[model samples]
Target: MWLKKIGGLVAILSLSFSGMAIAETTKDNFYLQVGSNRNGDPIVLDLASVKGTEYTLLEQHGNGIERRTLRAACIQGRLFSRRLAVYESNGHLTRVDKTEQEIFPKPRSADANSMEIVCRVAANRTK
Candidate 1:
């Protein structure tokens, strides 16, 4: 009797966990929308000055315009949004010298993230 009771409890716990996972997925979907402003407003990406090696992060968010600084690292980086592709530079794992045709028109084909990095292959060649 005890073994049966314990098995039933485990089954209930498993179901609860699965339900929670679905909820988490729904939360992430909000960010995929272009003008949705899932976090109540758009995020502002920026680079900090005075103390730095030049890495821009999503620093602020609000006031309608999501701002971002075009720093050196960003010059040949890879950024993606809704179907629009942005070619910019990030430090090591990036390659920003390849032309749009060579990158996007690759032979094998790839996801957005890979396509962007492939285009910027001058810096990050292999992996």
Candidate 2:
């Protein structure tokens, strides 16, 4: 009887650890698919992470993901973006970069689509 109880406890512990491992590999559901980029990869925006004029965008790369933090200039329709970090498909941080770039979206481009959605959301919040 005691041996059975010990086996049951060990089983429970293993299940709990497996759950934690799964959680680490999955992303939260708050990121919404805004549009697709030039390469047809899905571009997602973390609406819940928006702060003031800055928002987080996640782009699907080969087997990993690249996350960028961008500040919007709504009136001028521009985005100031910085490469924040990259994560593996298993949701592990690979590296972090702070290289900044200024974007002026050309007509009918992926960046233009993203800028429109982001600015609209930001504009609505101020009212």
Candidate 3:
């Protein structure tokens, strides 16, 4: 009876530890699909390469027209845009506008407009 209890405890502990490992891996590697542009081209934002509190917003436009990067911050699972400076692929700041609205993730909804850009947490496929 004592041996059975010990085995059950071990199994429980192992499962908890595995869950923690999975959470840690996903905590910093979240991605957001930023939707498509006015031209019907898709855009994806990758936050998986974030380091510490700072993160690089990699904007990959579907067409070969525009590709930019913006410096941002992530706080408690909510990403905040810090500036309006859009940088080129070569690290050159091209446009700076203080009126640019900050971006954040929103819940996926069925009534979302097709032209409007909506962001949501990327689904984890490892499950």
Candidate 4:
């Protein structure tokens, strides 16, 4: 009876550990995929590690920008800033933004914490 109990405990532990896995996002950087299927079914992939600023395209849709590097702390396809849409590796609009880039001359030197982007309003319509 004791032998049987020990075996059962081992089996239970093994099964529990099998499903115990850390999410793709780690202590540093990562990736994710959020979009729809061919039939317009929503899907998501919390990816593994992502190294640099340049994103890696994982999958592409027929219309929207290709999903790429996982934005840490993003939810429901939006970033922490709650940006309306995402973009492609090649820098295509995620939806339709009517924003413009700030055209300020670069300072003598750059600060690690300061970054800038040029935003443009979306022209395409998808509802």
> Which of the numbered candidates is closest to the native, going by highest TM-score?
2
In candidate 1, the residue pairs with backbone N, CA or C atoms under 3 Å apart (3 or more residues apart, or in different chains) clash, namely 76-88, 76-89, 77-88, 77-89, 95-120, 95-121, 96-120
Runs in model 4 deviating more than 4 A are: 1-29, 32-36, 39-42, 45-59, 63-82, 86-89, 94-127
Residue 46: error of model 1 in Å? 3.0
Per-residue C-alpha lDDT of model 3 across residues 10-101, encoded as one tens digit per residue: 22111122122111112234333344445543343334543333343333323122333333322233444444455454455566654433
* Model 1 lDDT tens row, 21-79: 11111211111111112454322211121012222222112321222222222244433
Q: How are the candidates ranked when ordered by lDDT, highest leading?
A: 2, 3, 4, 1
User: Considering summed lDDT, which 10 consecutive residues are worst modelled in model 2?
Assistant: 17-26
| Candidate 2 TM-score to native | 0.65
Question: 1 or 3: which has the higher lDDT?
Answer: 3
On lDDT, the stronger of 3 and 4 is 3
What number of backbone clashes does candidate 4 have, counting pairs of residues 3 or more apart or in separate chains? 9
Query: Distance (Å) between predicted and true CA of 102, model 3?
Result: 5.7
Report the lDDT of model 4 for residue 82: 14
| Candidate 2 segments whose C-alpha is farther than 4 A from its true place | 1-28
Please name the candidate that would achieve the greatest lDDT relative to the true structure: 2
Instruction: Tell me the spans in candidate 3 whose CA falls farther than 4 Å from its real position.
Output: 1-34, 60-77, 87-92, 97-104, 109-127
TM-score for candidate 1, please give it.
0.16
